[model samples]
Target: MPRRCATRNDLMKPGYVYIMTNKNNTTLYVGVTSDLERRVKEHKSKKDPKSFTARYNLNKLVYHEAHQMIGDAIAREKQLKAGNRAKKMALIESINPEWQDLIIGDE
Candidate 1:
């Protein structure tokens, strides 16, 4: 069978940079994904029990930002990871002062 060509819509899928945290907000996990909902669900489900986020119980979707390109999202994720906890907390508080779980009503 002939391979299908890429469409504009396929190329425009958005990417996301998200932060997950434990209940106490002591641990922050920054990640980038093209499918934010699915990725968050996997983290909440402890899909990889041995992973750092899962091990630290960091399932709360505290903060997220959308990007038009995957590269931008990845770069933002890297910046967040390299920054200190104070910087990360400031970013989170700017959008989610209470650190409410963004996925709460989706289920």
Candidate 2:
């Protein structure tokens, strides 16, 4: 569980805790940062040209947890990253059984 900040009413700081899966759904990537839009855009565009995400085609924004503080988001990302692949798949599956690539929940 994440430690609650002493402050309440956390503002949306544009940070995102996100997960990505390979085309065959055999791989997963967990990450967090302050720029959800730009980061997801890069992944979808394969902008890095040679990144782990791009190499694996892990561009689907399958699961995400928005946070007000980067610290909280990072912590959550780390937790998810340390989990087993089955656990990770289950997490995404619970929210999106069809593995819908819900970028920013625009759909």
Task: Tell me the TM-score of each prediction against the true structure.
Answer: 0.84, 0.78
Q: What is the lDDT of candidate 1?
A: 0.88
Error of 1 at 33 (Å): 0.3
Q: Write the per-residue lDDT of candidate 1 for residues 1-107, one digit (tens) a residue.
A: 69686466655677899999999999999998889999999999888999998899998999999999777787788989999999999999999999999887332
Indicate which candidate wins on lDDT: 1
Off by over 4 Å in 2: 1-14, 104-107
Clashes of 2: 0
lDDT of candidates 1 onward, in order: 0.88, 0.79
Which window of ten consecutive residues has the lowest lDDT sum in model 2?
A: 6-15
